[model samples]
Target: MQRYFVAPEQFRGGAVTITGEDAHHALRVMRMKPGDKIIVSDGESRTVLASVTELIPQAMKADILEKLPQDSEPAWSVSIAQGLPKGDKMELVIQKGTEIGAAEFLPFESERIVVQYDAKKESKRLERWGKIAKEAAEQSHRHRIPAIGPVRSWKELLATIPDYDLAVFCYEREGDAAQGVGIGAALRKFREGKLLSLEEGRTPSVLIIVGPEGGFTDREAAEADAAGAVVAGLGKRILRTETAGIVGLTCVLYEAGEMGGE
Candidate 1:
């Protein structure tokens, strides 16, 4: 079944109202009409089976048949603090990061970062990135859309570490130090045999920091280490700037009991 996302404001009682760009895409691009069946999510991480009941010029309304609890989300909330890579790679990162269930994305400026965001144009870029995350979330049936945080300097990134339960910084230089137990290994030891209740909240909330294309400088690595962020290595092989977050998030998800059923 086709799936679409609606903001909480659009939901009235059991009916969901769709408007704006999403409406245009559904009505004109997707050619959806009244009486069609579609799935709608509140974009807060819960999905509902919605049947198209009304299609108007500027709006579309769907009747919610059932509220389906979203189980795809990993119990752990991961925040990606990525060093700004050049070109359109950040867009790809945000899109895929959302599908893999990132709670938030933070663009960090590093010593080796080549791409710079201007004060005048950064807001527009951030806005577009936010939209990309929303669309990706809908496509992946994520109940909540991940947020794109404003670009942060290296110093600003370090100050936020205390708020997270686990902070991992991906570093190519910390080669031997990176050999700590894999996320899978950690999860098995820490959380195996735990109850499946969400209210207990035993899953770890993770914060991952990835460097830019040129990667982080040696000093930056030391700084990250000082900030209580574990300098973990992904593996023996090197990963691209855009690829690191996926590896990190995948590990986090698997560790949080979201992948590969026993």
Candidate 2:
């Protein structure tokens, strides 16, 4: 069944009111009408099967059939903190990352990043990225859309490191045998409960940080290491900036047994 994410307020008295782009999609794109079945999510883990009761260009209403189980989300909430790369690679990162169950995306500026940060264009860029995340979430049957954080500077990004239960820095330097622990080992430790957060019963949150094209500078890497991040390597072979986050996330979910059948 086709699924759409709507605001919490849209659900009232057992009926969901779909508005804006989703309404247009239901009315025009999907050609949904009364009696058509669709799934609706409030994006807060509340998902339901609904029967369309009304349709218009600006709005669509559906009567709730039954609440659906929220099983699509991963046990570990992984957020990707990507260093802004050149060209449209960010879009690719956001789209694929969302599909792979990334809970959030954080695009940040780094030392070797080539793309100049533009405050004027940030809003439009965020809007487009958000749209991409939303579409990817709906297609992937995710109950909640992945959040896209506003682009941050190097210092600003480091400041948020404490927010996660565990933060893994995808440093190329760690690829050397003599360097830091491997990504698999770090995640295994997390999976084994060695890295559990102080909060009991809370879903473990992980932050995976991937550097841009030229990768992180030594000074920057040091800063991240000092900021309580677990420095880990993807593998001996190098990966593009956009590829690192997805691979790291996959490793995390796989380690958590989220990629396997229940």
Q: Evaluated with TM-score, which candidate comes out highest?
A: 2
Tens digits of per-residue lDDT for model 1 on 11-40? 889898888887777888888887888888
Residue 52, candidate 1: alpha-carbon lDDT? 90
Candidate 2 residues 161-209, lDDT tens each? 9998889999988987646689988887766675554466678889999
Clashes of each: 5, 0
After TM-score superposition, the amount by which residue 181's alpha carbon in candidate 1 deviates from its true location, in angstroms, is 7.2
- What stretches of model 1 exceed 4 Å from their correct place? 176-199
Clashing pairs in 1: 43-143, 44-143, 45-143, 45-144, 178-233
Model 2 per-residue lDDT at 88: 96
- lDDT score of residue 75 within candidate 2: 82
